[model samples]
Target: MTLLLDSEEGARAWIGEAFAPTARQWQQLDRFGAMLVAENARQNLISASTIPTLWVRHIADSAQLLSFDRDNEGLWIDLGSGPGLPGLVVAILCDRPMLLVESRKRRCDFLRAVVAEFDLRHVEVAEAPLERIETRPASTISARAFAPLDKLIGLSTRFSNESTRWLLPKGRNAVKELALLPEAWQRMFHVEQSRTDAESWILVGVGQIGAKQRGK
Candidate 1:
C-alpha cells in the first residue's frame, strides 16, 4: 500500500471498493455528523472552524483506523475517545464490539446519546478517564490526538495483552514523537503515512508479552 495519499480521493482509493459503507451505515454517519454540529452549539466538542472539513477530517480520518484490524473480530477500546471519533465512527461502520472511553461528562453524555440515537448494540461508552477505568482486555486499542506515545502506554497497558492490535494516529510529528519513546517500544511499532495528510502517520503495534514484561 502507498501509505500516504493526496486527498479524500486518495483516501478512498487507498481504502478501495470493498470498504464502501452500506446505506444504513451512511445514514448513521450522516446523523452523527449533523448531531455533532448541533451539539457543538451546546458546548465545546470539536472546533467550530473544522466543521467544513467534517467528512474528511473527522469522519473519514476516524473510519480509516479500522483498516489496520484485518480480522475485524475482537474488542476495540478507544482511549480518551472524546466525541467518539474513530470509536463511534467504527461502531457505526463495523459489527465488532467496541468501547469508547471518555472522561468528560458532557462528551460522555453526547456519546451515550449518539449510541441511543443510532441504537447501536455493539458499542459501549465508559465515562471515566483511562487511569480510573478497570475494563477487560481488548484485542484492539486506538487513540487519536489524545496523548503522546509514551504516556499512552502508561494509560492503556491494562487493556492490552500480547495479541492486542494498536491503531494510534499521530499527526505530522509522528516520527519525532515516536523517537521520544523508550527503547523497548521501538521494536513493536510500525509507522504508516496518513491518507488525509502526507505529514501524518498511523502507528500500528501488536502487543507482546516481552514488551510488557520489560516494563514498556
Candidate 2:
C-alpha cells in the first residue's frame, strides 16, 4: 500500500509504525480535510468550518473509542454517523463488522465514498433512520455528538440486548447525563482525559432498561 504520509513528520512516523497494518487508513484519515472540504463545497456533508480541527475533532476523537473493549466479534453499529466519527474509525481499527446508519442520502453517499476510497471491507453503510432500520442486537453501539444521553439511550434500546455494550464519547455533560439514567440501570464510567480537551471522556458500559420499563 502506498503510504500517504501526514505533513507532520512525527505523526506520520507514529501512525506508520504503530498503525502499521492500517497505514493506508491512516493515509485516508490524513486526507480527510481535503475530502471533507471538497464535499462541503457542494453542500454534501459536514461544514467546512470543522475542517480545521478534523484530526482532533474527528479522527483522534473517533479512534479513542477503540480503547473501550477488546471483543471484536458481533455487530457494531454507529448511529447518526454524520461524517463518520468514532464509528468509521473504530471499524477500521477494530476487527468487527461495522454498520453505519444515517438518514440523509447525501451523508450516506459520502460514507460510501469513504469506505470505497479506503477499500474498507469491514464497514457497511445503511441509508435509513435509526428507528426505521431492522438490525439484530449489536455487541457494541456508539454515538458521538449526536444526541443527548437520555434520548440516545432510548433510541439505542431498539437495537440493544442485555449483552450490548455502549461506548459513548461525551464532553462536560457526561456526568450530568449519567445522572439522568434510571437508578436501576447500573453503570460505571471513568473520566479519561481526551486528546483535544482536558475534561472529555470516553464512557463505556452495559445497561438494560430498568425492570419496571423492560416490558414496555
How accurate locally, in lDDT, is each candidate? 0.82, 0.70
Q: Where in model 1 is the C-alpha error above 4 Å?
A: 1-18, 209-216
Error of 2 at 34 (Å): 2.8
Could you tell me which 10 consecutive residues in candidate 1 have the lowest summed lDDT? Answer: 9-18
* Model 1 pairs in collision: none
lDDT (tens digit, per residue) of candidate 1 on 51-160: 87677678778878887786859899998899988899889878889899898999999999999989999998888878888858899999996898878876787778
Clashes of 1: 0
Candidate 2 structure, TM-score to reference? 0.81
- Tens-place lDDT digits, model 2, residues 1-216: 222223344334443444464555666666665677787887656556556656655665666566556654789899898878777777666668899988889888888998898777889898997888895788888888778877787777768777778888878777777777665543433445554555666567775564466433
The all-Cα superposition gives candidate 1 an RMSD in Å to the true structure of: 2.3
